[model samples]
Target: MLKYYNELLYFAQKLVGDKEKAKDIIQETYSKVLETQNKREIKNQRAYLYKVAKNVAVDEAIQNQKLQTAVYEESEHLTQKHEQPEEIAIKQNQEELFMQIVNKLPKRAREAFILYTIDEYSRKEIGKIMDITSNAVEKLIKRATLKIEEELAKKGF
Candidate 1:
């Protein structure tokens, strides 16, 4: 189990894209595996550990998505008294345009850009999460930025 710790952590990180969350998932996986082991005889511990980690990560992702949706819906009902209607509409339009531009990016480039800009992850951290070199992460981010800039320029903003 100790020998597989590093391997499982890397696997979980790739699945979830967050180091601390991956560690928590791995811990939960070990706990669940141990509880199951006590109940029955197990032949393949390594495979079992990976399967458990995958399942836990998937479950967490689903839960997070649901929570985010609920929060977004709730926030929609809470109006900001300070912002005028024009200001609110402009902000929403800007956000929508930015999202449209980001969606046009290639998958890897978009992920790198979002991790760096939106999620506030450093290039080194993004590289580790994406399993790429820091240089590769930089290139991806640059490509994404260039595409976004071009799109925004065309829109006269």
Candidate 2:
């Protein structure tokens, strides 16, 4: 429990790209995991923790987007307190650029990259999550990396 704190925090931070948000995510993940009797029922405890963390982080991201848009509709710039205008602008710019790169990837390849690279999911677990072979996951990751590299090189990265 205490041992995996840093790992879980790191995973959530990668998923959301925010430290405070990541802390919330980790706390929620712990709460959810404790709610299920399966906590003591699973042999693969670390994998279970990671899976729950991924699900919670992803859900929070999606929910946050909707909430932000609603704030915009109200003619309010700040979705959450402490998010300054310049910071928001920079974040939006980065997100747009990142999505542009991601758009170049095939659907499955992008998903594989998100799971493996961003969420740090194991190859075997990602295969199980995506319902594909681990070999296929490897191939998809390779292709996705190449495509991203090519795109970045075009921009002189």
Candidate 3:
């Protein structure tokens, strides 16, 4: 159980994408799993623990999202240092172009792709993090992959 804690922490971090939030979520998950185990008819302990942890993670994410405020103040401050609106406009244009390309990807495929390609995660590692099979990760990456020729053709990556 203690050994699995490290893996659990890893999954929570990847799922939450924030170290501090992941720590809180994992701690809550451990407490809940222990308390539930003590009071319940023990069935599949491992699955039960995973299910409990997953639920806690989901709840935490939803709760955090509801309170989130998307702010561009920091970006605006940086733009002041850029000395010109052209620089700011260029930055905005680049961001828009990148997102346009990303939006073309399938949902799970894009998630797996960004995690694996952009973040340099392994298929096995991403599988555990995304709660999917390794083969599924591979397929998602393959499906989302753009050939160099195709990217060049569309002027997108």
Candidate 4:
């Protein structure tokens, strides 16, 4: 098992994009293999491990999509319905300020940051959605954060 660790990690990361999630999938794959209790009966342990890792990654991704959908639905019902005019004006001003900051980001970084902060997506999920690697997603987010902070400072916020 240890011999195949590096390959398994590479394969899982290719499929899932997130290093942490890939590691979790690898761990779960091992747990599933252990659960069988008939290791001697298997002929191709390497192939079996890969198969388990694929299935686990797919299952986790589907579960994550469902959870994101549920959270989005719940948030829809939680928005404040009644606001004083003064409060509404203030909120609008804040939104405008935020948008100004966000607009200053590079296109990729803007999308990543919005998906991560406003849409509540994981870095891995954001990578999948953006068709980029998780490491790329992380970089975009970091860049976006720095840009936003700089903009806020310039605006005396």
Measured by TM-score, the strongest candidate is 1
Overall lDDT per candidate, in order of appearance: 0.83, 0.75, 0.68, 0.79
After superposition on all C-alphas, the RMSD of every candidate to the true structure, in Å, is 19.2, 17.5, 19.0, 21.8
The sequence of per-residue lDDT tens digits that candidate 2 reaches over residues 47-78 is 56777887887687567675465435536433
- TM-scores of the candidates in the order shown: 0.48, 0.41, 0.39, 0.43
2 against 3, candidate with superior lDDT: 2
Candidate 1: which stretches are off by over 4 Å? Answer: 1-82
On a 0 to 100 scale, what is the lDDT of residue 116 in model 2? 92
Higher-TM-score candidate of 2 and 4: 4
Best-to-worst ranking by TM-score: 1, 4, 2, 3
Residue pairs with clashing backbones, model 1: none
Deviation (Å) of 19 in candidate 4: 65
Best-to-worst order by lDDT is 1, 4, 2, 3
Cα lDDT of model 3 by residue, 1-157, tens digit: 4655766677677656788887888789878888877897644444454556667876875676742331333243343535433344445555666666667777788899889978999999999999999999998888777632355356542
lDDT by residue for model 4 over 56-139, one digit each (tens)? 987897788855654566476554643422235445656788898898788999999999999999999999999999999999
**Candidate 2: where are CA atoms >4 Å away?**
1-95
lDDT of 2: 0.75
Judging by lDDT against the true structure, name the best candidate.
1
